[model samples]
Target chain A: MAGGGDELKLLGTFASPFVMRAKLALSFKGLSFEDVEEDLANKSQLLLESNPAEKKVPVLIHNGKPVCDSRVIVQYIDEAFSGNGAPLLPADPYERAVARFWAAYVDDKVLCHVLEAARGKTEEEKAEGLKQTLVAVETMEAAFKTCSKGKPFFGGDRVGYLDVTLGGLVVWVHAGAALYGMRLFDDAKSPFLAAWVERFGALDAAKAVLPAVERVVEFAKMRQAQAAAPATAGGN
Target chain B: MAGGGDELKLLGTFASPFVMRAKLALSFKGLSFEDVEEDLANKSQLLLESNPAEKKVPVLIHNGKPVCDSRVIVQYIDEAFSGNGAPLLPADPYERAVARFWAAYVDDKVLCHVLEAARGKTEEEKAEGLKQTLVAVETMEAAFKTCSKGKPFFGGDRVGYLDVTLGGLVVWVHAGAALYGMRLFDDAKSPFLAAWVERFGALDAAKAVLPAVERVVEFAKMRQAQAAAPATAGGN
Candidate 1:
């Protein structure tokens, strides 16, 4: 399975950051996979069959075996394709645990608040969510220091699990600033993460997979307009 | 670090199912550790320092390094003590991913609904939570067959990652029955899991650490009564 003959396919949408995480991992690992785009409004049978539990995108099918969830898929890629490229996770058990903890934080704290800010019903609630998102960013700024240890990247001079996990949102940061005048990370507030954001975005692998900021901003606007309109079938 | 000289300490509360997960992993791995019970109401400085991000329990301190979160701690225990006992996670990468997927299902689908059932503000909401929890149980029943492959456990003939993960809720299953006449798993609803509930609970390793069922029921009742009472400081 680790050989070049392995068949890897990803079922995902273009705009999903979660799906982007999977693409980023595959790109970083230097594994060429068939990118199968799914219409999220009317999901594909492959996506449904692959992940009946969540019925969500970002299902990485490696040689016909499906790995669902972005975090799980990233770890699966690192483990299954260990011989492909530089390791996404460090070898030390303790360091691996630390990476896992912060990766989970990226989704649980940062992404959760980002969604809340986007979807909150009231102005006050959205403001609070934005405030907490910044707080989460500050926390991750500290985590970037702890995990990177003053190195160029979280995996210490190479992108790793944490980088790919948070990297899913790099384009969204730019789109967010364009849409809501929000800056998730800034030079004054989260200098390390702000710098890392640019450094990470500049990488050839990341640049190849990350959606363009204008495209994401347009997509977000369309979704917002759709959400504000009357309810209809296949709203997602 | 895999030697017998490893220093392990756990900062946790008695009744936390999450903390019980770490204990179950340690006990299954045949490793001994200091169980430093925490006053969650007034959490210790050690707890605060150990887990500054969430400040929650089930923080496993191994050789003075803190590993926060039950899921992370369990994996750390397995990797750090790989030779101490039978491996908690399987050797195969795909199988490991499957185990992780279901272990997460236990928390996201099962535990989340269980908490909603216990904490929902209205009767309708609580009933909905209970309904969803049962549906999740049925989903896991099918997952057990997929992972176990007609074997005794999710790890196949022995407790593995999923077992230890869902094992945290075994006591709660019994306590729920006593408290609300609720059978989360039954002969008809989930025959395999119903039998597994009994088999897993009877293990010496499990009995050694699992809190008594009656004690949990009493604790739940006390907490419910407290919730109905007036507000006060340090209520947790």
Candidate 2:
């Protein structure tokens, strides 16, 4: 829905949670952007040309300059259109540091463990993966408990940049865990986190832009099967 | 020489580059604090209590509040004492985003490759690790070429937050590469990167606080030996 004069454009793959991150941020700000879906398997010329080094999607092109990396893109969007929506980050230095810390922690710790679990091959490997995932979840739960101050989202009452970044990954995590026949979040164990998940899920912006859960599940299943297929074929 | 009522204390270990990041920032800003060197092998009760979750060193305690993570600690220092030193981050939002991107890239790509190379058990693993390291180096070189704009340091003549964050790891990278028998930064191949390295190393602050190269080399050797010792003893 972006207009012609120096319009905003987002190049992303549908399945990427990273892409969802940018989408949610832009939408929350009520900014219009042209969503150009890139086929990751057969990457478009523009996608490659725009992001030559990484050649990965979720590239935001504004006034001909491209910004790569989801977190970077989110920050860019927040700054470029400062007046569009609520401030993505707090103004106070300590609070801003806390927000950035959690965002980076999500990338470093949570995603690392989740990816390991998603890619586990053997039963033992899968079990170990699940254990690590649980550890990550517990750590996140603790972080939230300490930092939340009774706010519904990471930023308190309303969803902010941290929530957008972390919330986008929930679908992928659930899908990956489902593929491994593991349930990572439950009310009994992580009531607050579970409530948070439900609250995020219920948001209109999230529901509108997020990829269908079924599609994510399918993609995860395909990835796991492909990984297992090669090893199983060798046995045959 | 932090005077009365200046409550800044840094808990860190000698060998950690992450800890050095906070130290360099503090030094650059000319802020004095009580430096607590932690024995990482046996963390102090205060460190354990301060950073209960990660329990890692490089915890910056300002006025009784603890800030964990080296990058976050740097930002905290920058914000808490903004008026004291050269601005750590750029005033422009876009430029700031670019800086944060590079910082995150260093942590994710560069550090990951170095750690992998350090832990590789076989020749194939080592080779793969080296290849990844080269890719990271290449990416950094490209970023520097585009973004540095002939700036001596990352922050145009003065060493800023990005430089300190990345510069802190130079000794470790050089030493770790040597320990793994890999040439990570060849002057002939990475001239710009090599020059930048020299420039960063020449900083008075860096010269003062950076652990001696020989010490880093010895540390890497010790770590590698410890990793291999158990397997060698088992073979015997």
Candidate 3:
């Protein structure tokens, strides 16, 4: 739990992997916070006011001060609550830089490509997105080899910033496999990451925060069905 | 200067704002580094190996360990040389988070839209980009007001991370006016930012790193002429 005077409140939806990053960070740190579920369709006044520019979720309010963006929020949690938990960022400056580099890679290359693969407008676009995603995954596998150096995690025997950043997508990875028959990390290609997925997902903290895979699959299905409904009606 | 034992090298192109960010950070921190100019058209092996994933410039090598990405490099410089100069990130965690939020906004919102407006595919695309750029500029103007707190700089009386992040674009802001008659910040709309451009550019450290405006304008014109040549030849 956080120090008595500190009040942490997370404004996010259940389904967002970005939101999950914040939850996982908090859980790993053992910091308790009010998990405020948001209706993105009808964004709350707090959400709008908290992040007036972007109005995106996963805004972590610490002692009434809003820290927007998951990456910023995660780092904030680590820095603000430094004494309560194992540090998310490393002590050494160079190591911290490396961790930050990979954390950025996870978002810029991996997550963005994955989203494009799943949500592209055309089959060709989706195929291109998948192709780029495979390249990103291969690059990430190499990064894992370098960073982990045979350790169980990227942080060399501990869960750190990169772990938490990528850990957010654990459920979605399963959901992607279920819906598309596409496993991002597989035994054939990215063997290290393939094993890492299982290892990371099995963590108690991760289990607590990560949404159920079946529930995510159902949500995705519902979203797809809704998207198709308009097209179907238009055709009629 | 950096500590006696510390050796710093930066790989970057002169024209790139991303590269300028790294330069600005180093300068503001009063760190002396060997500035190695990279021919982006034919990248160096060091850059390729240093950043295998992105192969982008602005890779800072400290004692031979390469840190890629401008954002990561800036933060790394601050951390690695904590004792050398004034801290780029604020000491308080909340303030650091706010600085980061604005730094990200500068990149994702302000710079990106500016690029789109300048180099969009069609007239309509350019127009839309300009419209978005105006919106982003307005938001950033407000950010400047809130962050600076009636002070001269975003760091409040000293140059900080957000200043360096946005400072990279100071030359371009001048060049844009010369080329496209588009001033992203103007007295009428974004008075703070308009004044900020002039104040940030005049600093000794900033002046040392920032490229000349006329040089940038000449380079832009040359590039534009080259682009037109291919189209002209194809038409003929």
**Pairs that clash in candidate 1:** none
Q: Measured against the native two-chain assembly using Cα atoms, what DockQ does each of the candidate structures obtain, in the order listed?
A: 0.90, 0.59, 0.92
Candidate 2 local lDDT, A1-236, one digit each (tens): 13336578999977787898999888877777899988776898888888876788899888777888899888888877787768787777777777877887787777766666656667688668668777777878887876678888987888887888887776775665566565566677777887887798789878878887789888777665766686756432
- Stretches off by above 4 angstroms in model 3 are A231-236, B231-236
- True C-alpha contacts between chains kept, each model in order: 0.86, 0.67, 0.94
Give the better candidate number (1 or 2) by DockQ. 1
- Residue-wise lDDT of candidate 1 within B150-183, one digit each (tens)? 9988899999999999999899889988988887
RMSD of 2: 3.8
Chain A alone, TM-score for each of the models?
0.96, 0.87, 0.95
Which residue segments of model 1 deviate by more than 4 Å? A232-236, B232-236
Chain B TM-scores of the candidates: 0.96, 0.89, 0.95
Clashes of each: 0, 0, 0
On the 0 to 100 scale, the lDDT of residue A47 in model 2 is 88
Candidate 3 DockQ vs. native: 0.92
Candidate 1 scores a chain A TM-score of: 0.96
**True-vs-predicted CA distance for residue A144, candidate 1, Å:** 0.9
What would the TM-score be for candidate 1 when compared with the true structure? Answer: 0.97
